[model samples]
Target chain A: MRINLASIHVDDQEKALRFYTDVLGFLPKNDVPMGEHRWLTVVSPEEPDGVELVLEPDDHPAVRPYTEALVADGIPFTSFAVADVHAEFDRLKGLGVTFTQEPTVMGPVTTAVLDDTCGNLIQIAAMEAPAS
Target chain B: MGDVFKALADPTRRAILDELQERNGQTLFELCTRLISKHGLSSSRQAVSQHLDVLEAAGLVHTRREGRYKFHDLDTSPLRTITDRWQLPTD
Candidate 1:
């Protein structure tokens, strides 16, 4: 019933690992060998037990067209929930992460989109804290 | 095309995936029935088929033909990749 795992198909695992960890600050969770491709995963250091993001290889026949079309249309592959989108945006920008959309406020939520450098655009979003 | 995010982004598609996960192997008719009865989804056969095609492209689903019946199964390896990447402290 509870959700735990999610995946992001990357063009290259090693390169994706570097961007996800070095730039995004996610902690490496798993790195099991799977022949040519290793079974890899990463966790947000802030929420270690929250959920795992899989860094999968985009070797499947259907993946390329799927990713390319989205990229061409300027769509984010998936979004991550953040405590503060603005702060995370600034922090990530400082680390040379390229952003497609700057922090934007829309009623109850704030969001920003960035390129993962692994052939996908990712979004970071946050909800406004309710007033007491 | 099998965009994992695009495949997963839709509520109906997610429901279809859930159906396959709960029951490993099911024919198209069975899936359509369960989706309507259990999830109250009112999509047409064509719509469900299209969604299944999307999921298949995303590698979330696998299919095989046995005799006259084609059955669908949730591969689940892709799901594991997501969770495995963000592993627990057991490492």
Candidate 2:
């Protein structure tokens, strides 16, 4: 049917929580203790009931290699929609965020990629209106 | 110098050089995105990577690793070989 949940494998749950909430400005949606790791998720404040992002753990053997391979080639694990990619890139850079790719115009979209610090590269993008 | 000519023969490789010229340093992902979006190149990532290898062999592109990420940069010094072989007449 419709998508309600999306997920990203983070190396540490606590660090991910802090980065997602304090830095990236996502609100905590769920945090239930499930043995050693908790079912942690965060939602955009603007869309509280929208898709929740699960901060899954990267404890599995395959996850490290998978994430590392993607990072080595500068590929982003997932992309998030933003209103203005250049403005967000500037704001995030002010807060000590490292961007692998600066805001670049790619046809109808402007995009930037940043290191999440949890073993993943996240892309932020914004659509531009067509030229008259 | 022959390798340079061979490398420059491909349209995709030239496009890669153009993007690198626009922005000196770029990851393979950024190059791929530019090629597909700006140049309408339908080449796969692996294919684009192979093209990069060709460029590197010709000394037109150089790849550097900064920590965990790898970036591709353009170096046009090799193109001087052409000028060295042939000189233009002044009026």
Q: How much does each candidate deviate at the interface, measured as C-alpha RMSD after superposition?
A: 16.9, 0.5
Best by DockQ: 2
For candidate 2, write residues B1-91 as lDDT tens digits: 3398899899999999999999988999999999999999999999999999999999999999998899999999998887788866766
Tens-digit lDDT track for model 2 on A32-81?
99999999999999999999999999999999999988998899999999
The native-contact fractions of the candidates, in order shown, are: 0.00, 0.91
Docking level of model 2: high
Report how far off residue B2 is in candidate 2 (Å). Answer: 7.3
lDDT by residue for model 1 (B1-91), tens: 3667788899999998887777676656556656776778899977988998988998988877643235688976666655677876775
Give the number of the best model, judged by TM-score: 2
Q: What are the clashing pairs of model 1?
A: A6-B82, A41-B85, A42-B85, A42-B86, A54-B82, B2-B57
Please give the TM-score that candidate 2 achieves against the real structure.
0.96
Return the interface RMSD of model 2: 0.5
